[model samples]
Target: MRRRLSIVLTLLTVMMLGVIVTGLSFGEPGAAPMDDYFIENSQSESGANNVVTAVLFDYRGLDTLGEAAVLFTAALGTTLIFRRRRDD
Candidate 1:
């Protein structure tokens, strides 16, 4: 029963993944107007030479900080998990 359930869940996961991939593959590829606006004005607005840096650090600063915090927490958790177990 356990093995059958595992197999069913695995098949469902693969089917869901295939459907997601197929849906994404059919998306229209084009430059959005917002992207063009950002490219044209990012340097002047943010005073950053690199547009990507300007957008990430200036426009999306809070989101970037949150991502960094999450990464730091993950690293700390991994380090703790892998630390030597001292036999007391």
Candidate 2:
């Protein structure tokens, strides 16, 4: 048990060190380039002042409805999974 614990601890230390080294290597994404295209397109198409409201209420409403349907389906599936099936 002691030997297993030491081996696991050593492996965990090595993994954490690897992650820390990786963090120093890659920089975070630039903001301007990412937002520019989407901002330009969504604003032109939607015709609304507030971007989030336009996206949610008008432009992407279908997508939101699909997402709601998916959530409803998941809930129904979960309920059905826990339900006792009648064999009559």
Candidate 3:
């Protein structure tokens, strides 16, 4: 009985995962909506030669920096957790 239950649960979990993956939103691989003014203004306002660079590195710099910080913090946490504890 226990073995049958385990197999049923495993199959159910696999089917659920397949359903979720199949329902995911994966549209055209690469596309952009760039009105020329939006790009030109973004470049000049953010003070970078490239508009995309300005948008990513200037306007969104804080978010990028935060992502880096979070990654660093997670890595540090994981390392500390797995590291050998000192007894001395």
Residue 31 shift from truth in candidate 3, angstroms: 8.2
The lowest-lDDT stretch of 10 consecutive residues in candidate 3 is 29-38
Candidate 1 regions exceeding 4 Å error are 1-30
Candidate 3 global CA lDDT score:
0.83
Please estimate how well model 2 matches the true structure, expressed as its whole-model Cα lDDT. Answer: 0.81
lDDT at 53 for candidate 1?
Answer: 98
Candidates' C-alpha lDDT: 0.91, 0.81, 0.83
Model 2: per-residue lDDT, tens digit, 1-88? 9999989999999999999988885446555674565566766777777777777867779999999999999999999998998999
Q: Against the true structure, what is each candidate's TM-score? A: 0.67, 0.42, 0.50
Candidate no. 2 TM-score: 0.42
- Strongest candidate by TM-score: 1
Query: Which 10-residue window of candidate 1 scores lowest in summed lDDT?
Result: 25-34
Q: Clashing pairs in model 3?
A: none
